[model samples]
Target: MKRFQILFFTAFLFLCANLLFAQINAPSPIPDRVVLNLTENPATSVAITWRTDVSVSEGFCELQPAAEGPLKKEDSKTFKAKTTTIKYEYGDEPVIDANQHSFIFTDLIPGKKYIYRVGASDFWSEWFEYQTPSVENDKFSFIYFGDPQNDLKSQWSRVIRSAYRHAPDCGFMLYCGDLINRAGRDVEWHEWFHAGSFIYGMVPQVMTPGNHDYNDLMLDPHWNAQFTQPTNGPKGLEGTCFVIDYKNLRIISIDSAVDSELENENGYPMQAQKVWLDSVLQANTKKWVIVTTHLPFYSPKENRDNKHLRKHFQPILEKYKVDLVLSGHDHSYGRGRVSDNPQAGHKVMYVVSVSGPKMYEAGDKDWMEHSGADKQLYQLISIDGNELSYQSYTASGELFDEFILNK
Candidate 1:
């Protein structure tokens, strides 16, 4: 036992030294902004994405089950990564170019820890470890945030870090929308990535596109070029609108700006989404059904009422009896159901929140049970068998709000 402990300690130190050296001598071809994303079936599948300098055309990922002893390269399985060259000339700014690489690992053993790295064979990334979701109704937690869109590196970083400290073993992190202040801006994306460096590599991300994720010209081309999500959505809505099944929970991500964009420009239409959403809801077998989008169905102020989704999505969501409808874009916090009637059992809870430093004047409204403004917050949601608990926390780790739901 003593020998094993000494060997483990030595191996840990060796790994740390290698990581430090890699950071100090980071090269352009070295993978940066590496993130794990949710797949169709997270229990047996996971998607990874990373960026590199255009110098590297080919990319690779090596994976193996996490172990206590030495991590041997001989025991790892190698997979070729798909790389996309992204070049953009934003307005008058100099043209930006970068390579984005993505891969999906499937047939993973449920509930097992896996260590993996991404890069070329000659230059590999430091090992990252994450456990696959179990194939059961197991107790699990996940973090949810709204619009980490402004001052991401300085302000939004703390909210996410606080969420990690509250639930380090969370199955995933759900971003409601507006991940950055501008669409297709490299420097802003850099801030978003740099803020949550290692956390992105470890936990799988659930990203829903917000309005700012696009621009007046069209939806950001980089949206799909970056995150690798499910293609099981409607014909035109692939990665942007999809479903993920993890444990006994089913999550649906929808694009609410479609109604406007779909008519004028080529975009994911609400009608197509309605058909797909109805089908998905009908076939849902998970115990929990949560929907995330960039637009809220209800707004604290009258001017911001999301008629875009209210007329279409609100009815469908209520009909299907979804447990939670989570969204961003409001820049404030509000949580409640539509109706105030007590007899309206099996009501769907609606929540709109923000995690970035952007401030808005949130007024008290009749539809909201709890409302707040100008405060960045994150939510920790846990599901265990028949009980679901939600806790909202401030950037400083103070408990802002909480609630419990029983099945």
Candidate 2:
């Protein structure tokens, strides 16, 4: 009876211990992969998007100027700034259902270093720091890459890392759509983030949507969830389409998907965006006006010519005398001047290039002054007053093409 009792007690204790271990060993719902968007407005404001496994009913961020004391012992400049947080929520689902959150920190000082960290009820994120660009810099540079579609892990990572290694001091990074081949898959999005991890947190990123960025004949959940841009520009064209102003540069991004089939029959071209663009261009006394889209008006890619887009937006670009039009979806490089008469003043330069593993053959065309095929490239653009300098570099950081635009 004594042995039986002892054995029974031992079995009971063992079962309880196993149950406790199972409960304790369960995965913790912690916030992860916090990415700071350095592209939008980095000086006056910065945006951060992070993912969490558990739903956070309420959350906020704390920020302070990054200290350069230890790094520069000879030069001691103590920096301090008040921290602010902008609260937001997506869907009313429970914590387990909610996965992504984005917040914008505004009213920041340009050219100042700021340290920040996010906090939530279930879990708290680590502290990270970044510096805002100096608005006073007359000559500023940025990186432009397009279409990181297909083979994101092995091939695309090289291109992204190469660009970062070459231009570490770039003010911002512009990705002209198709960040991933399939947007619905969480793993692919993770790979996209992994490929661009080095620069994604450091530099500001402005992204446009490519056809592959979409899923199931609609906007992809991943793209929509990760980015936050100006939605107040046009009523119907919100996320996929918007406009942002940085220093003397006014960037206008449009959703080619909407205008691709010429389906918006209610004077679609002449209605909202046209009026808004006219007002923006006319009102914008900025030194440069840049338009970015996923689809190029003239691309060498098979079955990728956007005739309707050219007919609708080309006149507007000419009327506004836009400085440049950057695009991708061609998987090759093509640059041309949009003026029918060369002496009639440079209207706009339409450029298409790719920065992914995919390559396409370039077709011989009269409009194409510079063309490249069988290579992966990204563009580095420098704007100084009236002069705009552009250099196209291959994945290995070799200058493949170069040009200048004298405004």
Question: Could you say which candidate leads in TM-score?
Answer: 1
Question: Whole-model Cα lDDT per candidate?
Answer: 0.84, 0.71
Candidate 1 deviant stretches above 4 angstroms: 1-27, 259-268, 340-346
In the range 214-327, model 1's lDDT, one tens digit per residue, is 788466777787789899998877788899888888899897755443343234476788889999999999888999988887776547775556656666777777899888
TM-score of 1: 0.89
Put down candidate 2 lDDT per residue, 1-407, tens digits, no spaces.
99999999999999999776533312134645566654345559887776654444444566666765433323322222222222222233111233566777888888887766665554666656677877763788888997888788788889878887887878788888888886465556667777776466667788878877665456666665666666746776666677777777888887775544334635553367667776777877677989988888777655567776766677777777898888888888899876544554646888999988888888877678899897888899999988999999998889998989887
Clashing pairs in 1: none
Instruction: State the lDDT at 227 in candidate 1.
Output: 86
| Candidate 1 lDDT trough over 10 residues, lowest sum | 259-268
- Give the TM-score of each candidate: 0.89, 0.81
lDDT for model 1 comes to 0.84
